[model samples]
Target: MHLYTPHMLLAFLLLCLAGAAFPCSAAPADDGSVLYSTDFTNAEGWITNSKDRFYPEIETGRYHYLLEGGTGGYSAYTLPQKVNGQFTLEFDVTPEKTDDGSSFRFGIGTDKKDSQRGPLLMVELANKKDGRLFYLKTVSKENSLNLVGSSPSTGSSGATVRFEDNTTYHVKLTYYAADSRASIVVQQQGSPDVIFTASAPVSGKIEDLTNLYLTAIGDGTSGPQAEGYIDNIKLTLSPTHAAGDEKDAKNNKGADETPAPVITSAPATPTDEPTPVFTPGPTRTPFPLPPTPTPTQTPKSGLGFLVLLPALAGGAILAMRKYP
Candidate 1:
């Protein structure tokens, strides 16, 4: 009753053709960026709304954001995906308390149905008992660019973080549509401690990021209205170029990045189709490249060859059937 020995039947026929030559996925690595992740459990594609003493619900996993003690009250979600150039808006807010009055405004600009939305780009986490406006804006009726510190703990480039009460913040906004520029990072979701950071410059080209346009302002004299819970929602769209850090951000996007254009080497047909690139598909983390350890490109071990190819195809179909 012992068979399968031809070097264990060629390692169980390469572990029963190893899941048809190695395949196992949980999905997540199409880094073309224009992504839109969610963990709301359900309520698909979301388009919620509320105003004047706001309250927008979807609560079972999260998306609840009430502000019922207000002045110019509001609540919104209207995000269906429209970001055009570069983007990375992540979200995971949760504040139901910490002496917050209210203001959470997540980003991606101008689209409440656009009657004429002027190029927006937000991150205004404003809560005020006396001070707090964690900044990063990019409006455009003509001009607006507030980065780093808008007030209360400093504003103009870095130093802002007082969002704590029921804490669960993990915001990360990044837009770079070739210098329309943007940056905002706040962490404490799992806690790596980079409280906040900001960057600015965007007075044009914001025709619309369409939506993720979540808001939750409060104005009951700024002290007890803006509550929260805006779970995992993410959006990604910044992976142009042939990868490898966007080809080193396009060879250091010119701040006098000169080796005299690689010693005057003019012969580019848009840089030779990405210099014989091999890391295809918008480059790195459009998910699994066969468990990238990148020796030459793949198969370094592949999870013990995909757990020995289904236990060698269930022991060669139960030692060739007859399980009686």
Candidate 2:
């Protein structure tokens, strides 16, 4: 029998227990912070008083900001928190249907005086007669800085965006400090992996700074009164370096540590000649066969039968046996 030592038995039991535990993976660290977030099913911390009345409500962990009809529709949010550096602003926007059109705008800056009025960096989504997405900006008192249209490289030239009624659209804005560039990306819900990226030059002290406003604006532009929903507004500050650049650096360092695969010469084929063939000698034949086997006579048992049996059997066998 074999037995395990006390230490070995304890180790084996521990190994069994460890195997039953759930496998775990290292969790990625959260490197960003939320400056403002809301699910607008109900009205909270949002102002709806303007030339175009906007009503924001919060429900089901999502915020829906309703827009009233005809001209100058906007909503503003005075975020209790603020941030600077390279930050990303993200939210979902849904437009409502009406007769007099709709527009949406979000602002970020150092102003919390009032929703309808403030000094801030603004981004506007205005629905034009052609139903295109217009990117506009307002700094200080200079409103309507169209970076696209009639302005030469001033505003985004109004990219045509396909809008669906009651549908949710994800909007993300990323700021790169080193290059002084800001990019906006948008995608529709439940769609293929299609992303639209638009970029603009960033200037006027937007990097490595602090304290600003993060807001949303809605407008009804002439044709149909538009109201939209918003949810999950997240703002994050990321490193200035591009993700690809960091990955490339890591790959170069790994290449320095690991050796490259080498190609080797193929094995040489056998070159020795086969041995010369040699003929064999003549074959031999055997003689005739014997008769079939016959039964032997039985012997009576006695006190000396066992000892005499082997001697008698050997004598009979020797009388008929032949040597090879």
Candidate 3:
């Protein structure tokens, strides 16, 4: 018959302690520190182009970007300082009018001292030949216009959210500079839990520099121009870099002289609302999340083993003396 040994009991106790100290798996944290947030109460930080066609206004307690039967509109704002590593851009958008030829774009990158061109990574919401679609693009480091709108073909598989007139959506874009990758998620307010999600590799340098652009464009000969209401624009950064860092301070040098451009536009005026209609596109269903399992209490068998060790040792010593 085999006898219980002290070493065998010690091994079992160590194993149990190890399991408790280090779990096999855990989910990543989803929260981040807010670096910038705005309700659009005023256009204090934004810089609109000198051209009236691209200018936006703060009306009815929201930042309004309206393009009425025009080619394109452009508005941009430079960050107070450059950012690197991981950052997230989130905002709420209410589409007033969008059609087959309408395009709404948001871009981020380093803007040159005096030139409008720079390395940009952009997210485009538009109706493509395939149907109403959302896509991503990057202006290559070559600074060539030919490669400005070239979008990568591959992305995460999921239904695209088709925006109806006056329907609001919460959009989030997260970029990881370490891997040169980006992900986009859109959720319609008060409706679906999640509208759609897509991830793709981003091109260009993706420097942690200071420049963001909002663009609305039309095909000129197509349907009505694009118009959208934007609010609650926020920016978040990882906790590691939430505070100012050496790299950020280095980029801030000489930023005062050519700080964000001064934006001058016409007075605030409310535009007529567009008629509502059903937009034909993909039927988006919220992705199902994995069910969380309830944690069960760990067995206390290890403690029982330890208690038996002392008694067993005493018995074994006696048995050996009697046998000898």
Which residue pairs show collisions in model 3? none
Winner of 1 and 2 under lDDT: 1
In model 2, where is the ten-residue run with the lowest total lDDT? 284-293
Ranking by lDDT: 3, 1, 2
Estimate the TM-score for candidate 3.
0.55
In the range 286-314, model 1's lDDT, one tens digit per residue, is 11111112223233345676676677767
Tell me the spans in candidate 3 whose CA falls farther than 4 Å from its real position: 1-32, 50-59, 67-72, 112-118, 140-156, 216-224, 239-324
Tell how far residue 206 is off in model 2, in angstroms.
2.2
Candidate 1 lDDT score at position 197: 48
**Number of clashing pairs per prediction, in order:** 14, 39, 0
The local lDDT score (0 to 100) that residue 212 gets in candidate 1 is: 57
Q: What is the model-wide C-alpha lDDT for candidate 2?
A: 0.44
Tally clashes: model 1.
Answer: 14
Cα lDDT listed for each candidate: 0.52, 0.44, 0.54
**Model 2: per-residue lDDT, tens digit, 221-315?**
34544455567776665533455433433344322122111111211232354322212112211111111124344343445644554655464
